[model samples]
Target chain A: MDQREQGKAIVITSGKGGVGKTTTTANLGTALALLGKKICLIDADIGLRNLDVVMGLENRIVYDLIDVVEEQCRLEQALIKDKRNENLVLLPAAQTRDKDAVSEEQMKELILKLKERMDYILVDSPAGIEQGFRNAIAGADKAIIVTTPEVSAVRDADRIIGMVEAEGVNDPDLIINRIRQDMVDRGDMMNIEDMIEILAIDILGVVPEDEGIVVSTNKGEPIVLSNNHKAGEAFNNIARRLEGEDVPLMDLNNSDSILAKFKKFVGLS
Target chain B: MSAVIKTKIEEQGVILSFNPDYCWEEITSALAEHLQEGAQFYQGSKLYFDLAFKDWRAEELQNLINLIESNILPETDFYFMNQSSGVERDNKATPKEQPFSPRSAQENKYTKTAGNDTKLIQRTLRSGQSIEHMANLVLLGDVNPGAEIKAGGDIIVFGKLMGLVHAGATGDKGAAITALQLAPTQIRIASVISRSPDEDKSKELRPERAYIKNNRIVVEEVNL
Candidate 1:
């Protein structure tokens, strides 16, 4: 059962900040783990780390990624086991150290070590195409770009796609997060087609604007662990697709019920 | 004797070549007058005093430093270089330095030739990237939003232009900006600045050119 060479490292990046890169990483890691795959989520945001908190493993962190890279602790000591999933773990970024503390070579070596133990290593990259960004994509086999349905977000995604390709991480997938159905119905927002036209990348999944995401995030639980929310279902399908499953795209238009609309209006879902 | 103090603007800093015959009094007065006349050009710029074998007393050097410090911004730094024989510093002139200073007699001689030069970039300019040139600029790709292009002369973009652009940056009123799709965030030509309209622009995309006319910037379609 040790198919160590089959381990795939995917870096999740978005050039702009506040576009749900961390949230997507947390949900995707959680979803993949629920599928019985060995998963290690690495929060590479360094000083502004959030993946640990998003995964509800912040309190369990004793040794972080920096500790392992700097040889202060063994790799296993830095891996925080998820409370719910036995197959899932997290390597939290150093809250005190900045991105410069970890070099690209160090990141490459660390990912190589993790690949032997984990089936999938999901790297949550920091925003901006700087040294931190370069380090995040250095050892990744593929990239998943997260973007919103706004012009600014799409523009930034285009830039990030170009940079990702230039780094030789070919054929990055796109995940359009936080899509509002009502806005699209009113033609007030850019639909999925317009974003695909601009970014020109294969769509992985689309998560509709879900209030459940905020609740789950505040609760330090990934939305994918919940079965009721549409976003959770969407993330589950995304995980299935990553595992080479042919899951159909979630139909956001037909799923908009009157009760869901009322819940959105009252800010209570 | 009235000795000459030649001022040269270089990449390193502004070099004031002090003639050996000039006394401390002559150097101080001439430098003060030059500073007063072109205060804007010297603001926040480093200044170097090239004393051509001219040695100064300790008190005289202190007075000169005080005078220049009081006149310019606090951020501006000044250095002294004695190019006497056996000195450690290299005496060779900078090969790529462009001597330019606004509102001075040297402006007409340097800026005109610099403005005539053109640069061609054959790739897309992405966000957080900026391109600034002393002359005309021709880009053969898209200029994404959050990127910026500034030129002393004209700017020509072969593809979509959605970034902030400034043509005729050095006050060349005749300079223009032409693009395949001219939907930039902001446009500046010479002293005039304009932005895209706040209303919805769902109209057809067309090639357009922007130029300054009657002291205002105007955009017009490029007839195919």
Candidate 2:
């Protein structure tokens, strides 16, 4: 029964492509919706309409962001309601058109309109520090940068973080995604501290590399739909953190961080 | 060497001042050569070419633009300002500007770190960030890998110093660098430079200091 003044637009971006920007956006949006928050996801990666597919709403899309902007459909008509969660909806990108199809002003206009209906509007940005990135962050209130444990990914994350900070996005948080347990165990990969040291930003949470992600993605179902999976549980926690809760960072050193949680639950410390 | 270009970093971005006498091709080539190594710092930063002296022809200017654009970092913007001021566009709300402190430069002949030359920084310096000061610099946080701190006087860090640091940047042999944790990727004093050993540092990390002793840089433990 809490209708806020306006919704927050968050842009999920990674300078290097395929670092789970789309996947994180999908999972986080779903998790927020599950928490009873009205969520709307925008696939700002124009010419690459993947969020709709990831959300399992690709087949039901009759209109998209470009359609709404170009006056081909009403803003209400372009919104595709999530089959599972009525509070969740998605405005897919135009696959045939490139990033130039939408200007920064157009993006701001679309996002502003959506803010009236949703508690959160998550924009999944296209990779690379180009025009698309400019358009994606144009209307964002906060930015969540996603990166992996590799050196290249961290470097790109640093660059992207610097850009976002330069763009005046206040205090962007980082999400270390697809972390390999063996690498952390072997001391071969950069740990959470190492990544944070280099990037110098707050940690949202770490999601272990899960094969469940691939399966759920292929099935057009977000992993966050169920808490059985560790990756899903990770997103669920991140949603709480985004909602202003103090969720601790997911432990990466132990592959199963839940064993300790159960121990604490049983009063075993 | 004769100077063809000079660059200054500011709150707005990097200001590239060109020698007005140089031709467009000459200026562009010189910039390309200089930026080949320094581009990593200025890449993805805003740049304004201060070309007040030489009125260039349109074709030559276009050619210069083609060459300079390739070397620029992604999302980096370059605007040409004319004497009459073609258009004024200022992006004031950039969320990611460098942590810049406005201060006057220090004199090289100064003997000690005194007055306003010394700066006290209370946060970590992440990768791609650099701090260059002419006097003593004190940092209360860790200097992560890929960052650098250069000073003409003593440099003391309350936390880890894991990046590149040059204490005697202005050829002052008396300058010393001290840190709570000194595991820098590279260290320099005056003209000498040293790097972290490639071999695994099995030894315990302890507080240490580096200074020029007998005309050579030496590292020693600082006993409490």
Best by lDDT: 1
Residues B1-224, candidate 2: write the lDDT tens digits: 23688665433345678776677668878889876766654444456666666666888677767776778665556655443454332233443432222111123125234445577899998864778764578999998765678876689999888777888665566778999888886788765667666433544658899988887778899997
Candidate 2 chain B weakest lDDT stretch, 10 residues: B99-108
Alpha carbon deviation, residue B101, candidate 1 (Å): 71
- Over B89-176, each residue of candidate 1 has an lDDT whose tens digit, in order, gives 3213453333233333224424443533577999998754778765578999998765678876689999989877888766567789
Q: TM-score of A-chain in each prediction?
A: 0.94, 0.93
What C-alpha lDDT, on a 0 to 100 scale, does residue B184 get in candidate 2?
A: 80
Summarize candidate 2's per-residue lDDT along A105-211 as a digit string, tens digits. 98999899888878999999999999899989988999999999999999998999888888889899989899986788789878877898999888888888989
Candidate 2: residue pairs that collide: A165-B95, A165-B96, A166-B94, A166-B95, A166-B96, A166-B97, A167-B94, A167-B95, A168-B94, A168-B95
* Model 1 stretches with alpha carbons more than 4 Å out: A1-3, A254-269, B1-224
Alpha-carbon error at B140 in model 1, in Å?
A: 60
